[model samples]
Target: MEKKRSFPKFLSITLIILVVVGAFIGWKAYQTFIGPSVTDKEEFFYVHTNDTYDLVLARLKSQGIVKHPDLFDFAAKKMDYPNSVKAGRYKLIPGMSNRRLIGNLRGGYQEAVKFRFANVRLKESFAALLGNSFEADSTKFNDILNNEAVAEQYGFTTDNFFSMFVPNTYDIYWNTSPDKIVARFHNEYKKFWTDERKQKAQAVNLTPIEVSTLASIVKGEALHVDEMPKIAGLYLNRLRKGMLLQADPTVIFANNDFTIRRVLNRHLTIDNPYNTYRYKGLPPGPIMMPSIASIDAVLNPTDHDYIYMCAEADFSGYHAFAVTVAEHQVNARKFQKALDERNIKK
Candidate 1:
């Protein structure tokens, strides 16, 4: 009788201990799964290329993003997340559970970065500017951008590849591959040149690339956005007459001297195809990345008979347009006198 009573007592004590241990384990698990694991402050965390599991943990701890690094570590290990780390920019919210965090990482569910750029001029400059949106080094981007074979595959050459980029904003992922970015741009270009726009180009008797080249010249000449169409018309008039476009912007582009505020006869004699005074047709490439406004101005050029434009004598940003040689000479003389008064000799 005594042994049986003692055995019952021992069994009760063992059950109590087991319950306590189970409760503790359950609590820990609940904490790991349902408890807040990330601080409510930071918005994002960067998982760099090839960042090891240990490094990510360290980063989390160092950035103070993780409220319980030890618990997260345990959860990550249990989920087998170390070997499949995804490189990207990820958004984080405050009071997030480790379960969600680890699951998101495992799923590679990073959001795309908001990328915006414009007014890119040179190929090298564009490569460097665009490289900031991705993980790869800019030099690799530059090489790819300059590769003639690659550009030609996209209906462009390295010489005219600058025309490929339409100046506008974009949204891109941080780890987006270079080729995909190029493809996206090409798609955007195709979408931009709608059937109606293509018809307009046909009416102007210029190819898309030719229009871009002319638009670049027009963009360089005028400051007022309203004047772009008129400038386009003036250049078109010159083109239709088989006369030289004689664009000062083209001369500046040929000389590769952006500091020349005024074009001189010396700059025109650079013996380069970019100089419209020397070359009867469009330059082989765009002088700079033309703006959408400029491109549209070309396709929808105002129909006019004006063939000459000279800076106004009043130092206004506007230009004095003329339809006759005598009228152009008068405008030119007035502008020259103004320039002499300002002592702005090239």
Candidate 2:
């Protein structure tokens, strides 16, 4: 009977040992795969474009993302995440698991930047804006923009290159290269010029680029959306009648001075191709990035015999349209009187 008791006692001890081992294994598995591993203060962790796995691991520890680096290292290696590190901005949940973090990193799931701009007047400023927004260098972006060969490759001159970027909010990757950014905008430009838009542009006797240029002028001239089509019609009438565009915004652009409240006689006499008062037809390029509303206004201009426009006397952000020079002069005198009354000297 004592021997039987001893056998049962030994079996019980064996069962206890097995249970302890199983519990330990289960705890370890949970710690490695399911337990919270990330504890960063910030909501995002950045992985640069050329960061190695070792570098990323070090960053994880330094950034307080992982308390136990060795466990993270082991997991990374096990998942073969070292070979597939993508550069991007990754979101960090407060209590994420090692498996999930590594999976996201390996899978290249990252947030996109909402790239946006408006009223950008110069290519340099455009490049600067891009540099501030992306990882690419500003100087490199400017270089590519000013490169005649590169512009030629894109079937554009440096003069008309800025027209390719239609201003609006775009979902773009932060790590996108400068060249790729240009290429992407070029693709968007192509997409924007649909067959219907092309046909309308042709009917208006303007190429896509020329339409953009004219649209920029129209945008410059009008602030009210309802007035855009009327202003566009006036400009088109001038173009058809072989009259100079005589756009004040072009004078401001040529002077590189945005503070000009009034375009004086001296401003009109400036010997620059962009001075529409001196040169005929649209400027070699856009004076500013045109809005979609302005572009469409040019595409679907109001049919009218109007050939001249002047800002209204009441500062209502509207224009006075005319079919004859005498009527235009009357509107101009009213605006001049208003400007004089307001002391709007250039």
Best by lDDT: 2
Candidate 1 weakest lDDT stretch, 10 residues: 1-10
lDDT of 1 by residue, 1-346 (tens): 4654345778899999999999999999988887888896678888888899999999999999888899999999999889889988888988889999988887888878776666666788888887776777688789888898889998987878878888887877778778788888899899888999889999999999889999888888878889999999999999999999999988998898989977888888899989999999788999888888999999989899999989999987899999999999999999999989999987
TM-scores, one per candidate: 0.86, 0.87
Give the clash count for each candidate: 1, 0
Clashing pairs in 2: none
Cα error, residue 310 of model 2, in Å, equals: 1.6
lDDT scores in order: 0.87, 0.89
Question: Please, what's the RMSD in Å of model 2?
Answer: 3.0
